[model samples]
Target: AQSVSQHNHHVILSEAASLELGCNYSYGGTVNLFWYVQYPGQHLQLLLKYFSGDPLVKGIKGFEAEFIKSKFSFNLRKPSVQWSDTAEYFCAVNPRLSGGYNKLIFGAGTRLAVHP
Candidate 1:
Protein backbone atom coordinates (compact mmCIF):
# COMPACT_ATOMS: atom_id res chain seq x y z
CA ALA A 1 0.00 0.00 0.00
CA GLN A 2 1.06 3.64 -0.50
CA SER A 3 2.13 5.46 2.63
CA VAL A 4 4.25 8.30 4.00
CA SER A 5 6.94 8.05 6.67
CA GLN A 6 8.87 10.50 8.83
CA HIS A 7 12.19 9.24 10.07
CA ASN A 8 12.52 11.53 13.06
CA HIS A 9 10.31 10.84 16.04
CA HIS A 10 11.86 13.67 18.06
CA VAL A 11 14.30 16.48 17.46
CA ILE A 12 16.00 18.99 19.74
CA LEU A 13 17.56 22.29 18.72
CA SER A 14 18.35 25.80 19.84
CA GLU A 15 17.04 29.05 18.52
CA ALA A 16 18.52 30.24 15.20
CA ALA A 17 19.62 26.74 14.34
CA SER A 18 19.14 24.93 11.09
CA LEU A 19 16.47 22.28 10.76
CA GLU A 20 16.05 19.29 8.54
CA LEU A 21 13.40 16.60 8.84
CA GLY A 22 13.45 13.50 6.74
CA CYS A 23 10.37 12.28 4.86
CA ASN A 24 9.75 9.43 2.49
CA TYR A 25 6.85 7.74 0.74
CA SER A 26 6.13 4.42 -0.94
CA TYR A 27 4.20 4.85 -4.15
CA GLY A 28 4.74 3.82 -7.74
CA GLY A 29 2.23 6.07 -9.49
CA THR A 30 1.44 9.73 -9.61
CA VAL A 31 0.93 11.24 -6.16
CA ASN A 32 0.64 14.53 -4.37
CA LEU A 33 3.05 15.31 -1.52
CA PHE A 34 2.52 17.67 1.37
CA TRP A 35 4.02 18.85 4.62
CA TYR A 36 1.72 19.96 7.37
CA VAL A 37 2.82 21.64 10.58
CA GLN A 38 1.03 21.86 13.91
CA TYR A 39 2.10 24.47 16.37
CA PRO A 40 1.57 24.15 20.10
CA GLY A 41 -2.15 23.81 20.80
CA GLN A 42 -2.88 24.61 17.16
CA HIS A 43 -4.34 22.68 14.29
CA LEU A 44 -2.48 21.40 11.28
CA GLN A 45 -1.72 23.72 8.38
CA LEU A 46 -0.14 23.20 5.02
CA LEU A 47 3.55 23.97 4.85
CA LEU A 48 4.32 23.02 1.25
CA LYS A 49 3.28 20.69 -1.54
CA TYR A 50 4.51 19.09 -4.74
CA PHE A 51 1.99 18.09 -7.38
CA SER A 52 3.67 18.71 -10.72
CA GLY A 53 6.28 20.91 -12.37
CA ASP A 54 9.61 21.65 -10.72
CA PRO A 55 11.00 19.09 -8.32
CA LEU A 56 11.87 21.74 -5.74
CA VAL A 57 9.11 23.58 -3.91
CA LYS A 58 9.05 26.19 -1.18
CA GLY A 59 6.51 26.63 1.55
CA ILE A 60 5.50 29.15 4.18
CA LYS A 61 7.51 30.05 7.29
CA GLY A 62 10.82 29.78 5.47
CA PHE A 63 10.45 26.04 4.95
CA GLU A 64 11.26 24.20 1.75
CA ALA A 65 11.52 20.70 0.34
CA GLU A 66 12.76 18.83 -2.67
CA PHE A 67 10.88 16.06 -4.39
CA ILE A 68 13.31 13.43 -5.51
CA LYS A 69 11.39 10.95 -7.57
CA SER A 70 14.23 8.47 -7.75
CA LYS A 71 14.56 8.19 -3.99
CA PHE A 72 10.87 8.64 -3.25
CA SER A 73 11.86 11.34 -0.77
CA PHE A 74 10.63 14.81 0.12
CA ASN A 75 12.76 16.20 2.91
CA LEU A 76 11.96 19.46 4.70
CA ARG A 77 14.71 22.01 5.29
CA LYS A 78 15.14 25.37 6.95
CA PRO A 79 18.26 27.48 6.96
CA SER A 80 17.74 28.98 10.40
CA VAL A 81 14.81 28.31 12.65
CA GLN A 82 13.49 30.35 15.52
CA TRP A 83 11.81 29.26 18.73
CA SER A 84 8.47 29.84 17.08
CA ASP A 85 9.33 27.25 14.48
CA THR A 86 9.15 24.51 17.04
CA ALA A 87 6.20 22.32 16.32
CA GLU A 88 5.07 18.88 15.28
CA TYR A 89 5.95 18.31 11.63
CA PHE A 90 4.03 15.75 9.61
CA CYS A 91 4.66 14.34 6.14
CA ALA A 92 1.61 13.39 4.16
CA VAL A 93 0.61 12.00 0.80
CA ASN A 94 -2.59 12.07 -1.26
CA PRO A 95 -3.01 8.90 -3.21
CA ARG A 96 -5.75 8.17 -5.70
CA LEU A 97 -8.60 6.55 -3.86
CA SER A 98 -11.41 4.56 -5.33
CA GLY A 99 -13.92 5.90 -2.86
CA GLY A 100 -14.38 8.25 0.08
CA TYR A 101 -12.90 11.74 0.55
CA ASN A 102 -9.36 10.73 -0.38
CA LYS A 103 -7.99 11.40 3.05
CA LEU A 104 -4.39 12.27 3.89
CA ILE A 105 -2.06 9.80 5.52
CA PHE A 106 0.28 11.47 8.00
CA GLY A 107 3.55 10.33 9.42
CA ALA A 108 3.75 8.92 12.94
CA GLY A 109 4.72 12.41 14.22
CA THR A 110 7.82 14.47 15.00
CA ARG A 111 8.16 16.54 18.13
CA LEU A 112 10.62 19.40 17.73
CA ALA A 113 11.89 20.93 20.95
CA VAL A 114 13.55 24.27 20.42
CA HIS A 115 15.23 26.11 23.26
CA PRO A 116 15.69 29.79 23.54
Candidate 2:
Protein backbone atom coordinates (compact mmCIF):
# COMPACT_ATOMS: atom_id res chain seq x y z
CA ALA A 1 0.00 0.00 0.00
CA GLN A 2 1.10 3.60 -0.56
CA SER A 3 2.27 5.36 2.58
CA VAL A 4 4.61 7.95 4.04
CA SER A 5 7.58 7.07 6.25
CA GLN A 6 9.60 9.34 8.51
CA HIS A 7 12.98 7.88 9.49
CA ASN A 8 13.46 9.82 12.70
CA HIS A 9 11.23 9.63 15.72
CA HIS A 10 13.19 12.16 17.73
CA VAL A 11 15.96 14.62 16.99
CA ILE A 12 17.95 16.75 19.45
CA LEU A 13 20.02 19.70 18.37
CA SER A 14 21.74 22.78 19.81
CA GLU A 15 21.20 26.29 18.62
CA ALA A 16 22.98 27.18 15.37
CA ALA A 17 23.32 23.52 14.41
CA SER A 18 22.37 22.20 11.03
CA LEU A 19 19.46 19.79 10.77
CA GLU A 20 18.28 17.19 8.32
CA LEU A 21 15.09 15.12 8.54
CA GLY A 22 14.46 12.22 6.25
CA CYS A 23 11.11 11.44 4.63
CA ASN A 24 10.14 8.83 2.07
CA TYR A 25 6.92 7.81 0.39
CA SER A 26 5.79 4.58 -1.27
CA TYR A 27 3.91 5.66 -4.38
CA GLY A 28 4.72 5.54 -8.09
CA GLY A 29 2.28 8.15 -9.40
CA THR A 30 2.68 11.89 -9.47
CA VAL A 31 2.23 13.24 -5.98
CA ASN A 32 1.71 16.44 -4.02
CA LEU A 33 4.35 16.48 -1.28
CA PHE A 34 4.12 18.52 1.91
CA TRP A 35 5.83 19.08 5.24
CA TYR A 36 3.95 20.27 8.28
CA VAL A 37 5.22 21.52 11.63
CA GLN A 38 3.33 21.47 14.90
CA TYR A 39 4.67 23.53 17.74
CA PRO A 40 4.59 22.52 21.37
CA GLY A 41 0.99 23.59 21.78
CA GLN A 42 -0.05 24.77 18.34
CA HIS A 43 -1.91 23.38 15.41
CA LEU A 44 -0.13 21.89 12.44
CA GLN A 45 1.10 24.42 9.89
CA LEU A 46 2.37 23.91 6.39
CA LEU A 47 6.13 24.07 6.09
CA LEU A 48 6.45 23.52 2.39
CA LYS A 49 4.93 21.85 -0.65
CA TYR A 50 5.86 20.50 -4.09
CA PHE A 51 3.35 19.79 -6.79
CA SER A 52 4.99 20.82 -10.05
CA GLY A 53 7.94 22.71 -11.53
CA ASP A 54 11.20 22.75 -9.53
CA PRO A 55 11.78 19.94 -7.11
CA LEU A 56 13.61 22.02 -4.55
CA VAL A 57 11.03 23.78 -2.39
CA LYS A 58 11.51 26.42 0.28
CA GLY A 59 9.27 27.03 3.24
CA ILE A 60 8.94 29.26 6.29
CA LYS A 61 11.77 29.91 8.74
CA GLY A 62 14.66 29.00 6.51
CA PHE A 63 13.41 25.47 5.92
CA GLU A 64 13.80 23.71 2.59
CA ALA A 65 13.25 20.29 1.00
CA GLU A 66 14.29 18.56 -2.16
CA PHE A 67 12.01 16.13 -3.91
CA ILE A 68 13.88 13.20 -5.42
CA LYS A 69 11.26 11.37 -7.45
CA SER A 70 13.63 8.57 -8.42
CA LYS A 71 14.04 7.61 -4.76
CA PHE A 72 10.60 8.72 -3.59
CA SER A 73 12.20 10.97 -1.02
CA PHE A 74 11.58 14.53 0.16
CA ASN A 75 14.09 15.33 2.85
CA LEU A 76 13.78 18.51 4.92
CA ARG A 77 16.80 20.58 5.86
CA LYS A 78 17.78 23.65 7.86
CA PRO A 79 21.20 25.21 7.71
CA SER A 80 21.00 26.51 11.26
CA VAL A 81 18.32 25.56 13.69
CA GLN A 82 17.26 27.66 16.66
CA TRP A 83 15.61 26.95 19.96
CA SER A 84 12.35 28.24 18.57
CA ASP A 85 12.52 25.63 15.84
CA THR A 86 11.64 22.83 18.21
CA ALA A 87 8.51 21.12 17.00
CA GLU A 88 6.98 17.97 15.57
CA TYR A 89 7.51 17.63 11.86
CA PHE A 90 5.38 15.48 9.62
CA CYS A 91 5.80 14.43 6.02
CA ALA A 92 2.73 13.92 3.90
CA VAL A 93 1.92 12.96 0.31
CA ASN A 94 -1.18 13.05 -1.86
CA PRO A 95 -1.07 11.37 -5.23
CA ARG A 96 -3.21 13.23 -7.75
CA LEU A 97 -5.77 10.84 -9.14
CA SER A 98 -7.55 11.18 -12.48
CA GLY A 99 -10.64 12.79 -11.00
CA GLY A 100 -10.33 14.90 -7.86
CA TYR A 101 -10.42 15.00 -4.06
CA ASN A 102 -7.07 13.42 -3.16
CA LYS A 103 -6.25 12.16 0.29
CA LEU A 104 -3.08 13.01 2.19
CA ILE A 105 -1.06 10.18 3.72
CA PHE A 106 1.05 11.33 6.65
CA GLY A 107 4.12 9.87 8.26
CA ALA A 108 4.44 9.08 11.95
CA GLY A 109 6.21 12.40 12.58
CA THR A 110 9.57 13.45 13.98
CA ARG A 111 9.83 15.34 17.24
CA LEU A 112 12.66 17.85 17.28
CA ALA A 113 14.19 19.46 20.35
CA VAL A 114 16.52 22.37 19.97
CA HIS A 115 18.44 23.52 23.00
CA PRO A 116 19.66 27.01 23.62
How high a TM-score does candidate 1 get? Answer: 0.92
Q: After superposition, how far is residue 28 of candidate 2 from its true place, in Å?
A: 0.5
Off by over 4 Å in 1: 97-102
What lDDT score is found at residue 113 in candidate 1? 87
- Give one digit per residue, the lDDT tens place, for model 2 in 5-81: 99999999999999999999999989999999999999999999999999999999999999999999999999999
Best by lDDT: 2
- The C-alpha TM-scores of every prediction are 0.92, 0.97
Model 1 agreement with the true structure over 48-75: per-residue lDDT tens digits? 9998999889999899999998998999
What TM-score does candidate 2 reach? 0.97
Query: lDDT of each prediction vs. the true structure?
Result: 0.89, 0.96
Q: Which ten residues in a row have the lowest lDDT in candidate 2?
A: 95-104
